[model samples]
Target: MAMEGYRGFLALLVSALLVGFLSVIFTLIWVLHYREGLGWDGTALEFNWHPVLVVTGFVFILGIAIIVYRLPWTWKCSKLLMKSIHAGLNTVAAILAIISLVAVFDFHNAKKIPNMYSLHSWVGLTAVILYILQLLLGFFVFLLPWAPLSLRALLMPIHVYSGLFIFGTVIATVLMGLTEKLIFALPSYSSLPPEGVFTNTLGLLILVFGALIFWIVTRPQWKRPKEPNSVLLQPNGGAPEGVESSMAMNFGNVDKSDSELNNEAAARKRNITLDEAGQRSTM
Candidate 1:
């Protein structure tokens, strides 16, 4: 059977992406129109780049990178191609995040403001560092040709958990950063000015988007379907028999019997043998 609820999951993914993009756009407008605009020179306006780029890259682009493999259409593509796209998008997000940090630092230094003073800064920096480390480990373990299969298998769970954790952490950091910005920039954020209202709405949208993305990624039934020609096959150039049936056994949906496994294996072996024999006869 096909993956259950995949259509609903896909719809949610699209909705989350739309909400996320709107939030980013709203943030830019808030910063540019109501507050200082973006710049690179040491000014308050220059610091606007920090929030804009962080929301765009760290939240939106990074989120897409994390979920690219879950896209239904991507199942038809080679696993290697998907992996390359995932890595490349993450690299771009990292670069944007780094530039955003530079913008914040430059503005603070120019204004003689202390850096890393707020809880937002502390958590945000930690999240960025952890994210970069995760990316590096994922690249070396999964994408590179040198890593052993055993090592990849061992690290796979850790990598997945840590990635989800970091994604949540980044969203939390963004919310904290928004709160900090509103407190500092708005004279009466409690009373709710237009800017404050807009900012708060943007934060809510971001929170919803992040949550939806996480839900989509975590749902096992929403996982991409395994293609017949997947690159995940054994080096001997054949898909492993009984993998799916074995999984069904755990759910009591399929009977577990040695006879069944043996028969399946025997059939696969017989097919291979017949194919080889036919090839020889043709030659």
Candidate 2:
């Protein structure tokens, strides 16, 4: 039953990821074929890079980064490797997102258009800033060797919640930006032009993608399996192994002699027998 549930969840996750990838591809096609192609020469077409990169990075890549830990295929790998992958993906996403912002700003400056004057701009900038901060905090606390274990434990929940909040903010900002672009670029947006309809559909797909990513990340059952003897190693060294490593980590690890373990097992068996006997008597 558990395997069936996991398979079902995996199917849903893959479907959502595919929808997001397609939506991003369609958005890029719409921009290049219908609106403007991408460039970096400070032309109006240069601005096209902003939306494309933002969608790819903030929406698509970030979604994958958020759910990387939840992927069942990574269960066999060490947690350290998974963490490295997660951080690496997020770093790439952040770099792409920053370049997208730079593209927008460069375009605006070249056109002599005022920047940060729109609600979309405000929300998007805020989201990016918060995302960068989240990344820095996560790196220093979780990845670096400076922080203690207690601090890492304390900050983990906050980091998770803020990450999800930033994801939602990015999606909301993208939706707003899409609406603003349609209103400005399409004269008949109020009358629902074809481009407007297509853009709205794309926006809906992005929203659904974000929702699915959030759902997968938050579901407790979908979390990655922690190894019983997993050890959080420092950057230098000092990692134990086997049962000793488990005890050192203190992740529900208890130190028990063989006799103690045997006694506990016998007690559990006796309790099960007593419970069965009581049930049979009641029947």
Candidate 3:
């Protein structure tokens, strides 16, 4: 578990660093674009929100990645931890989704989008705030010992909602980024790895990589032991064997055969006689 947490932490930290580094490069590119104004008028690149959103998105991604991947405890003892991690990731993801969606709209009206750059800036700032909150919550979870397993279950709804939102937002952001004039102002497309490097299309790369990472980390734990004892039923108490098996058997109220009833009666009678005989001998 420690190893897993470390790996997750590293992944998030590295990804965040990359995003920060890239933000600088992109900002420089935008500045140069503003000065050149090849196709555009010499507008002072008034507060475009793209940079902010990009940085925000990166922060969100990093926070969610860390929360989802880190943490040593499982559903057994540290349910609260699991829930907190899940909630933290989902919360970051939710903010990211909202910003991404808004980015889509902003990019659509790139020319008329009031304070487009500012929008990006605010989104980044919000992302930073949300990430900090998530980190705080994560620390709380880490220190906790026992927690209800249901806590993790409780976060599923939010997680699902946040995840769906991300899908839509990513798609929208990619599309708008690709088609808008803002992209044209940036450095030559060839300079980047591909034409759609900064477009919504790049989300596909993120999706694919995210999926791969999840698979790698959660692929499989050690093969489960074949024996029942090895199952190691959690502390959460469940039904007894008789009740569980009885429900499974689904035995309707059917009458027993006369012979079977007679045999059972005979067995009881024989046990009584044996007890009586033993008692008499002892006397």
* Cα misplacement distance, residue 243 of candidate 2 (Å): 11
Model 1 residue 64 CA deviation in Å: 0.7
Candidate 2 residue 174 C-alpha distance from true site, Å: 0.2
**Tens digits of per-residue lDDT for model 3 on 91-176?**
56556545544554544556565443644345434544554454444444332534343443344344444443443344334334
> Candidate 1 has what TM-score?
0.80
Cα lDDT of model 1 by residue, 1-283, tens digit: 3557767976898798899899889988988898867777899888999889999999999889888988876777888899899999998889999999999999999999999989899999998999899899989989988986656656878888998898899899999999998888888999988888889998998999898889889888777676664334344434344555556677564354666888999999999999999999999
Ranking the candidates on lDDT from highest down gives 1, 2, 3
lDDT of 2: 0.85
Q: For residues 177-249, could you state the per-residue lDDT of candidate 2 as single tens digits?
A: 9999888888989998788888999999999898899888878888776587654443233443354555665
What is the RMSD, in Å, between candidate 1 and the native fold over all Cα? Answer: 11.2
- What TM-score does structure 2 among the candidates reach? 0.80
Each model's number of backbone clashes? 0, 0, 9
- RMSD to the hidden true structure, all candidates: 11.2, 11.8, 10.6
Better by TM-score, candidate 3 or 2: 2
lDDT score at residue 246, model 2, on the 0-100 scale:
51
lDDT per model, in order?
Answer: 0.85, 0.85, 0.45
